[model samples]
Target: MTAPPKTPHPLLFAPAASQGSVPDTEIGRLFHEMDWSATPLGPVEVWPQSLRIAVSIALNSRFPMFVWWGSELVNIYNDAYIPVLGKRHPQAFGGRAREIWNEIWPVLGPQVDEVMQHGRATWNERVLLVMERNDFTEETYFTWSYSPVYDDQGGIGGLFCACSEETPRVRVERERDALLQRAQGTVTTLQGWFDNAPGFVAVLRGPDFVFEMVNRAYYQLVGHRPIEGRPAFEALPEVRSQGFIEILERVYREGEPFIGRGLRLILQKEPGGPLSEAFVDLVYQPVFDVHGRVSGIFAQGHDVTEQVRAVEALKEGDRRKDEFLATLAHELRNPLAPIRQSAKLVKTPGLTAAQHHWAIDVIDRQATHMALLLDDLLDVARISRGRLELRMEPVALSSVVASAVETAQPLIEAKRHRLSVTLPAEPVVLTADPLRLAQVLSNLLSNAAKYMDDGGAIEVQAQARPGAVAIRVRDNGIGVAQESLQTLFQMFSQVSSALQRAEGGLGIGLALSKGLVEMHGGSIEAHSDGLGRGAEFVVHLPWMQTESLEGGQPEAPQGQAALRRKVLIADDNHDASTTLAALLELDGHEVHTASTGNEALALAEQLRPDIAILDIGMPGRNGYQVASEIRRADWGRGMTLIALTGWGQAEDRRQAVAAGFDEHWTKPVDTDTLQALFATPGRAGSSQAGPAR
Candidate 1:
């Protein structure tokens, strides 16, 4: 069919000058200057026709092309392929294909061999290759095709290839993808921060104010409905009537922010649910687009319902304060009136001793009543300020009851109430403030008598339980109203009539009793069926064993051990000074009374008394001054100074010690404790003010 193609002189990658005097193309010019003998393809004059024709096709092609000639696969390429080869240009022209592309030969060599051996064409698109270019290993991508070049006799001689570097396109696409990912992350972070903000926030777009986004707080407030992409009126219809839509429209249209504080709204918690009142501090801020045009309204708010209600509650408390001031003035004048009348009666001519005693009783009773009321008020002050201290010790419950009964007896007799008493057969002991416990029970008993009509029955019962003792004070008098029972012990609470309030009712005795009982690990509760059905006040105190004293000193004296000692009593109140001196003398002690500190100091130096009891608030000089003066005297060195004060605060006790007093006692000290003070050293430390001594 064919007389075999013309056999070219040599298969040189570099064409000879005779071959159109070397190709005019860029690769041809480069090939002619290159040394072909240095390659396996030898010289330009010796290249075979198949190799020469392949090189010619590569050199003249507008597309990128490469040619490998001879058995060693020597390289030759076109001008368009120079940029694809990168820095491997002129030097690669005469080198073997495998040697020139050694960085990628592992993959390229196999493709070339497939085309040369099978006489087939192979194509690879965007094949990834790591190659050295510009002194660095570059991540490169290329599209390539390889075909076998046949010689004059139709036998394979070398490989020819066409390629395009896809690196630039691939790099651009990768950069765009990275940019998009960064944009998405930024948006997600901003959205997250908005959703977790402390206050509620939402976004509504368009003239219709379509819901675009809502934070968790805003979503919860609006009933957690599917609101996105919906109009505000459609999603939250009720809020439309509440002016929310009107404000949103104003913000969007005017590009201005709207703020509404303490705005009241009636809103439903869920769809089709009952509406409830709420208050909010709302803000509607306009969101702007890149063009600086208003695009949407950003709604933000906070719930202030509790803050609003607290303001209302404060107003109510102010109203109560005014009422309490009015009640207090009326109550204080009640005792003053009786005392004044009794004083005038004592001045009457030819007054019988019995009549004088009656007047004295009236004055004494009224003064004592006023003193108890002041004590209750002071106790409340200490309780509220957390300055109250408890002197706790183990004492017999029977003894506590007897002391409480003694304190309440005057009030019960004054009211002419029929009193009944019941006590446990076994001794119920407790670790508590015995004085405070007595005060608590006495307050409850006195309160019952004060509230009850004359001759009304009152009961005092003590029951010992497994772990506690309960003292019950019940009266068949004016029972507490059902509503009043709940707040009966609340401080400054008003429930009683004007008459009851005038009868020395500060409305804090029960509250003070509760506070004192609780300090000693006890509880008090009041219960009643209704007003006039009779109210019952019960106090429960933890029961403890007396044997657990653990070798400690006895809590109190067991029996009366009267000691005769020379004693001086000082008080501005004549009745208090005389009454105490008389009591001391009755116990077989030489006693003297002083109406002031100067009188007491004179008596103390003359008598050189074993004990000097001084009143803290006397006229000429206070008890502390007298005690200091007495302690400085040589004759007063051995005498014990006991301070009597109306205030038994911790600071008061400290001042007493600094003034050289050996003991400090609050007013109206128990008769038994006073006698014991003569038998033993009193509680001496500044931090203490009890009968421990």
Candidate 2:
């Protein structure tokens, strides 16, 4: 043994143990114990100077560090890197880098090759690595750097690495980023809602009340001025004197909210324009900072100028109504006084037969005049309340004209006006309410007679036009002023001069005529040059061709009987169902009724009725649910489903249609309307009752 020690080769000799070349650590001890001859780098003593220095540096570092050397890329690491290795620790101390980290070799292999082949350094931050640790793959993150170690000949020999696990910090940062994204999304959504808010919304900041934010409605209220970032009082100087600025100041100073209801403010809506008054119902809520000190104010309100003006108009209307009532009383007393005198005269004894007859005629004429006035008033009221029912039927234009002329002949002859009637040679037929049309025509003719001077020329003409007929009533009379034409068809509206000349009228004839014309899907207009220029009233009515009227069963003709058919009524209210069933029975239709959605479905399946009128709000499943279920059945596919609900809003109709209903009808639907539905062509005795849902 002494001879062998004396003969030891200097090239393979180990460094002195006392020299402490290796780090005095766990990985250092393992590195010292590992046999380096098995690796491509061979023994530690034979390692190149550059690699020795790199390994020494890696083993001594406080941070996790590693060394990959030689063509095999053998692994060498410090004590700080042991936890990174997990169960591969002691065994992985001096093993091949790619073999020891084969699971992540694909990720790190290229990076190592780059540094080794190019002699360049590589740095990566928060690089993700799924590594086997504690006998299980763990999700971890790390930041590391790889620098080439040069040999004595200035050639790349190995890689020196320094790293730190970033798993906890990286995960925390990712979570924070996700939270921030959600918060940002919420802010964006809130901003959208604020911009589209219906009411005027604004925010003011600081004691000067600078405009910080404003919505679309606010911009409209303020006339689109460039007011953002400017002081409220400075931008809207018109509002300063109106006490709006003071109100905002008070809210900001005292931190107390103020609700202003119908506050009147005079503003200059346009630059250099006249000041106008506006009313607003608003609230000034103080916004506080972190210290609970008032920072600004939030303002939201509605422009109530129309409401204020409407209240004033209502007051004026009440005064006008009072005047009208007084006039009515005086007019009524005038007729009553004459009737009383006539009655007394008839009752007097010793009166001649002629005198008695004259007195009786006076009473009769006055009573008839009073009855006429009451009838006009009643008609006006009924039309205003939408209670006037039109009995629509096929009628000849000649017949309507004759009926009107007969009604107005007494008035025309009494006025001694020269009248002319002209019509198209070919007879014109229309689907119209004959009586209503006659009434409209007669009212115009009577108006002409009443307004015209005696012996004035009156002309009634009817001409055919595409899709309509034009009926014109022209008269040489005390014509209406241009300003009066606009309101001539309004209720209780009359030209003052015309009223004076005509002696007496309720000022509703033209209004009633217009209403009647509109109910027939027509329009009426009056034209005149000016006072004493002769007025003309024209009515335009939609007309049907003679062939269509004669060939087909009347389409939606008023009061026409419907074909016999099967009908189902589903409603929760017993009275509504019973009454509707009775009406259908009267219309000659077989009917079945149910009070619940489920019962309706059962009855619908059993009968396969042609029509299903269902109440939207029903017990058990509701009408919408029942309608959907019925629509799924083969037998129920062709049935017409009508949604009969008290809710008649446009949204309600949309929901009903979306729920598979063919029609949406509001409660209290007219019997005639239902009859019209059944009378429609292909509505009964056909596989399909209505338009498919």
TM-score, each model?
0.74, 0.62
lDDT of 2 by residue, 1-693 (tens): 355347433322337353355767777677767777877878776777777777767766888988887788888888889888888877887788888989998999999989999988999999999988678878999999999988778888888889999999988989999999998999898898889998899999999989899999888787868999999989998888877777787888788999988899887878988888888899999999999999889999999989998998687567646645655676677778889998999889999999999988887677667766666676677677776667788888888889899999998998799999999998788888887899899999999998888899999998897789999999988898998898788766767776576354666788899999999999999999998889999999997664234663333366665788899999999999998899899978999999999999999999999989999898897999998888888888888888888765455666887778888876566666788789886764354434322
Which candidate's TM-score is highest?
1
Q: What's the residue-level lDDT of 38 in candidate 1? A: 73
Clashes of each: 7, 0
Q: Which candidate is the best by lDDT?
A: 2
CA RMSD of each candidate after superposition: 6.3, 16.4
Determine which window of 10 residues in candidate 2 has minimal summed lDDT.
7-16
lDDT of 1 by residue, 494-577 (tens): 575423543546667778998998887789999988877788999988885442444643656667566678788899999888
Q: What is the C-alpha lDDT of each candidate?
A: 0.79, 0.83
- CA shift of 471, model 2, Å: 5.3
